[model samples]
Target: MLPEAKPGPARRLVDAIRYGNSVVLTLLAMLCALLVGAIMIVIADPPTRSAMGYFFSSPWDTFTRGWHAISAGYVALFEGSVFNPDSLYSNGHTPIFGPISNTLLNAAPLILGGLAVGVAFRAGLFNIGVQGQLIMGAICAGYVGFAFRLPPLLHLLAALLAGVIGGAVWGGIAGWLKARTGAHEVISTIMMNYLALGLLNYLLGISGFQAPGSNQAISRSVHGTARLPHLLGPNLSLHLGIVIALLAALGCWWLLTRSTLGFSLRAVGANPSAARTAGMKIERSYVVVMLISGGLAGLVGCSQILGTNHALTGDIDAGFGFDAITVALLGQASPRGTIFAGLLFGAFRAGGVVMVANTGIPADVVLVIEAVIVLFLAAPALIRAIFRLRESRGGGVGVGQLAKGWNA
Candidate 1:
């Protein structure tokens, strides 16, 4: 019997719109997650709910007062992290610039970190040790930034180069072990975490490497010549490093979608045996992909050292490398998507300080909210079932949608 006619282009497009459950489903999950988070926040801190109600009841009376307390508490973290906003002492309005600048400032590292994780996911490699890679990168950057004396721009570039080299070496180790000895990349990367952390602690404790008379296990601040300059006004926290992060994201996107190397990596990731049949070197691809992933992670350290901290400390990262997973997933593994997701995450993190200072809610509540959101995003089927929605083209539901939506 003759085959039935295939659907037309318009019909296929319509079907995809109706059944392609990736972006819409993921967004729905996010909305539901936010609703749940809001409820949790209200439950965790009743006083904030009461204040919210009071502010809602009266537009002008307590609205801005509540907002200021929430957003500008503890001398405005936004100002401290990003460019210092000029305090405009208006009658009622708080400085709105605080969160805006800080959001961009903090988003810089997330962009690169997200890129690292996102690119690997495309190649079917789950690199869980980006945190370790970033730590190693930071150490490398710190060592070069402080110890080396170079020309104006070269000094800064040298530090960044050190970060890339360190991160690449660590990532390459994981790849090499996986290829040569058949070790799982995930396990190897996880082990690398301890290696990175332990080595950093040892190095930071040494007199020559440690900050002078600080009594803390932190590296000395980079020299003035190596520091990333503020893109914003003088003395502002905003720096040119953010620009570099954005540019790097663009570069990664191009490399993944436009380059032959990226194609090989993606092919091997999709099916190693098939790729091998097609004349691709699966082992070589593994090593190359892992090294590139590590390099991207290392850039996070460069941004942290050059733009934000300018000094290396044990707490410099504060789980940002781990958090990049969320950012990458949220962005659906696209470079541009990662930037947007990073901004969203950065906003939540930046605002947490405000929430803590203004309300009775602990900043930990934000962490809880973030975790819940990630959980829901990770398993979209639960969200779909909870919402009682029909299944989309992606059979596994929203989590699958998140996985499929990278190229979507």
Candidate 2:
């Protein structure tokens, strides 16, 4: 028998490249965003522009000064979001885990919000009203947290359940409209957001929800019994919400990959007409998927109110809903990917403040980075063309696929 031929170094290199293609593309996109941000920084700074005037005459000086400014900004971002080695010895009172804790706290809601969008994407639904759903959830959860008197653990559970139910009902309305009246979810969801904002404004004026002796639009604080316990200590902001977010991510993964209903949802998303021909209940799937998606979104409110904020305010939603759409796309609509994407975005959010305070870089720069990332992700073909990369074995999903799913 002839000996089996071993794979050569070139063949192994090709396989590795193919296997990590998506990750490589994503990293490259991030690099492009950073480069753009650096250019913006230079343009915004008068000193940097003056130094660049002598690019050819004094190349070393120009390069060193420009690089120094860019590095300082990124270093501040890193220290604020991840860790600052200087903090270890510079301040005896500084908590070693403080920065990481804040990052986790910020990421918790993003994970839940991203899952909401991801779940809807899997079912051919566009749940743009996640903002409204989140608001409703916070209202319901906040009411339960302050009004009800119960055992500690049970009270917390009750408040969370109330939030979930509120979000489900809100989402179900859009699904029902889509199924019965042929209303597009996008339009219905947008309308619902306006309605929710109006309702929130009205409700805040009521004595029942408003804080005692306060003219502000904030609701009463949640009771201690209903509050999510801190995983770290009172000094740190990190709470049990991170644990819940991780569990929810795992649940979403199981639902999408293992459950029969998930299969039905995917089939409908791929082709509603074919799904209907196969005897699958497309309309019901829409309602079910939206309900679940909204419930997931509602958890963002829980994280904010019960875990972090502990009070309901007009701005409680914190843009998590819209940011989630980008997170979902960056994650490619996968639960695991959503978690990583959420963390990355969370880091940017946490770091932006430090970058601004220490390096004088505007916080809006982070927003620009996020927008650029979305631009690149939305056009994978452009990235491939620029990089001159060969197509991977499974190829890639694009905005076209997402659009087709919506139509289906």
Candidate 3:
């Protein structure tokens, strides 16, 4: 009888297992960064110095007690951010939904903004104006949400539509500059971002447009009818905007993969001259994609106002528009990737507080750990070295290579 064939470890493992390994590897990098950070803390002072002592006590006690405390705290952060926790901190029934809801709420806008950045990336456009577009969209949606007199559902829809219009118009101007004058989108978008912010503030604070009897510069409260409904009772904070964001992602997936318009977009992004030679509307593609991007960014503002914040204020967006850039990059410009990345970032934000509150670890350390993760994520080289990924720089796509066409 023929000898039985021997199998290597790679062949023995299932494809699902291999795929799961990749995800684990990424998480491992995050942990690795934390480990490195801990080592630095230990070497710098050994729990005796100002910074180190602030977290724990003496060095001898640190190894036995401090080390475990920090590790457990980080783990708690992970648990609190992603999974359901039925246990209560106090006597009250623990709302397992807290982290999950916050994750979705924080991610809702990231999804839309991620879509915006992802589309521009695909078209070789380095569109950085999502921040400005986001601000414009929020203020636009905010204005309509409070200023209108339509039925509730209609009012909400109208507010969202206004945001789309506002963002599209803003983005369209940049696209026009690009197509007509050959201005680089990176520069134009940067300028436009500032313009959007200034314009938004002006519109909201203007006497005629400002809320009555309110000296402070802010929009009026949204009509009860215009506000998004929470599936749970009013006590809960989640809303229908999450549903809208998901639908938008599905819609974008369809548009990019299946539609004729998508094909044209890809063609133009790949080669504008070639597209022109083949009779594709190159200028129109540039204009439309930026508008779509703007609209998507605007939707983020709408979701924030209509779903959660319930009104427009200067504080809206809270740098989320800027944060969405990291989200888009980390997600590799994929819709599902964006969703997951958004959750990861949101979880870090949610859990960092608790980790600090429960343990004596400084919250800023948690923030540093998070920042390091994204830094490493954006540079696959850092992750590759840490985990020894065999793939060479040219072997396959790298994380830094996600966005294309902007230099053109």
lDDT per model, in order? Answer: 0.76, 0.86, 0.73
Q: Of the pair 2 and 3, which is ahead by lDDT?
A: 2
**Per-residue CA lDDT of candidate 1, range 1-408, in tens?**
999999999987776545535565667766766666555554554445456666757656444454444444324434433334455555324444555667777788888899998887877777889989999999999899998889989998888899999998999999888778889888999899888988888888999899999888888989988888987665446688679889988998898889998887777766678889999888887788889999999988888886688788876667888999888887878888899888777877776665576555567766766777778777766766776766664455433334433433
Q: Is candidate 1 or candidate 2 better by TM-score?
A: 2
Prediction 1 global C-alpha lDDT: 0.76
For model 2, state the Cα shift of residue 131 in Å.
0.8
lDDT of 2 by residue, 1-408 (tens): 999999899996786465436677788788888988887776666667788898888888776777778888889888889997877897758778877888888899999999998888888888898899988888899899999999999999999999998888898889888888889999999899888878988888899889999999988999999999999899999999999999999999999889999889888888889999999998899889889988988888888899989988889998898998888878878899899999999898888888899988878888998889878877777777877776666656556677644322
Task: For model 1, give the RMSD to the true fold.
Answer: 5.7
The most accurate candidate by lDDT is 2
TM-score of each: 0.83, 0.94, 0.84
List runs of model 3 lying over 4 Å from the truth: 1-25, 33-59, 83-93, 356-363, 392-394, 398-400, 403-408
What's the best-to-worst order under TM-score? 2, 3, 1
- Summarize candidate 3's per-residue lDDT along 1-408 as a digit string, tens digits: 999998677764543233324355457657776876565434433343444554454456556554666566667676666654544564446566766676677777877888888777767677789888888888788778777789877887898899888877888888888888889998999999888777867877877667788988677787887788985657657688778878888888888778998778877777778889999988888888898888888888888888888767777777777777877776766677777777777777777666666655666675566667677766655666665665542343444355443212
**What overall lDDT, based on C-alpha atoms, would model 2 receive against the true structure?**
0.86
Model 2 segments more than 4 A misplaced: 1-13, 16-20, 53-60, 404-408
Q: Residue 283 error for model 2, in Å?
A: 0.6
Worst 10 residues of 2 by lDDT: 399-408
Which pairs, if any, clash in model 2?
Answer: none
